[model samples]
Target: MTTDEDELYDADEDPYALALRSGRGPVYLRLVDGRRIRMPVHRWHEQPTVADKTVLERCIGPVLDVGCGPGRMCRALLSRGVFALGVDIAPRAVALTTAQGGLALRRSVFDRLPAERGWKTVLLIDGNIGIGGDPQGLLRRCGGLIAPTGCLVVEVELHDVEERYNARFENLQGQSGPFFPWARLGRRALNSIAADLALSVTDQWSSGDRCFATLAHQGSSFDCPDAGRR
Candidate 1:
């Protein structure tokens, strides 16, 4: 079983090692577009408006940031009048979030989720498309963890699977530097994942040269959040 993620290139570092060592990671402003650059780790906690407004308007109920990092998005949401929570496999990340006056948990999405169905809106942004190996599996797992009316917002690189990661991919990516054969999960892939998870995307947009997708479980027919219902 894939318990912890590490870089095959480093051979002695966790996948998050680069993130922790450099104290920085990329934040894709949009769900697609695919380009991400390593930025200051503080930026992850700053809560930029680029990705925050999109989530604030569409997400319903408490929000969960899967891989919440230093609570950047979480902090942004709180400032926008939305209650947010965070989950990350990196202990340092969890600690950073809590230090920022946010509710965060130190756990992997593979272990156990803190909330039940329709309980909270979960954010799979910031390269969350690669959360659990396969995007489909990741979304499916999210489906089970989401509440009946919960939402799952995702972000992916909007590029070819191979070219994006610049990888040949024998088994899986994760064996090197800033590049890996991570599937971009563009529009087509996003739609398929949403369908597989019994979800329907309600809104999408781009910011800071990034693209994003907002998905939700709305019974059978897809619909937006309403004042009466939510």
Candidate 2:
């Protein structure tokens, strides 16, 4: 008889989880319109890239990496002697992170997390700003996760597009997982949402095909060693 843990593992046999365990993927996010957006799984499994460095440089110590997939960012930060913690809803993700010597927790951004409002840098990289398909709600939650002088670093779409819909994880072979709520926000859309949350966009820049923005509380200030060097 299969145990409940065995059943749980069996039920997680989706493309995303498989890719994480194997460290490879041609995984795609199948949108409701039938359009597929390719997910950069290989990059997530590898060491930090030049583009990733751009994000890493802006981060202050005691960082929180929301949706940290394979834990590359967390690992990188720890190697740099920066205290970082990665959180994800996937067990495999947290396992891989700790296995690689990075601190991680299997938890959702909306769930109760440690160090509430005390993290110096909160990251929503790899399109995680779209976590719940409710960008405004997500941003509000992130605002509460950072210190008053801390900042939130987010990666936005390269193009000008804002959308919310259900999406599935699909492999190249056409196998797919259950549909879940997802969203996409360009820089402009992110800025608008940040404004409503009383968060100010402190910086914005592009590295290769990815675009990023930094948001902070209206009157608070924090030290980013690489600020303005981009």
**Per-residue alpha-carbon lDDT of candidate 2 for residues 1-230, written as tens digits (9 for 90 to 100):** 97533433544453356446443348888998999888888888889999999999999989999999879999999999999999988877777788789999989999999999999999999989888889999999999999999999999999998999999888766677888899999989998999899999998999999999999999887565564663
Worst ten in a row by lDDT for model 2: 3-12
* lDDT per residue (tens digit) for residues 19-100 in model 1: 5432223422111244444434455645566555655666655777888887877777687788888888767677667777
Please report, as a residue range, the 10-residue window in candidate 1 with the lowest summed lDDT. Answer: 163-172
Candidate 1 TM-score versus the reference: 0.71
Backbone clash count for every predicted candidate, in the order shown: 14, 0
Best by TM-score: 2
RMSD of 1: 7.8
> What TM-score does each of the candidates earn?
0.71, 0.92
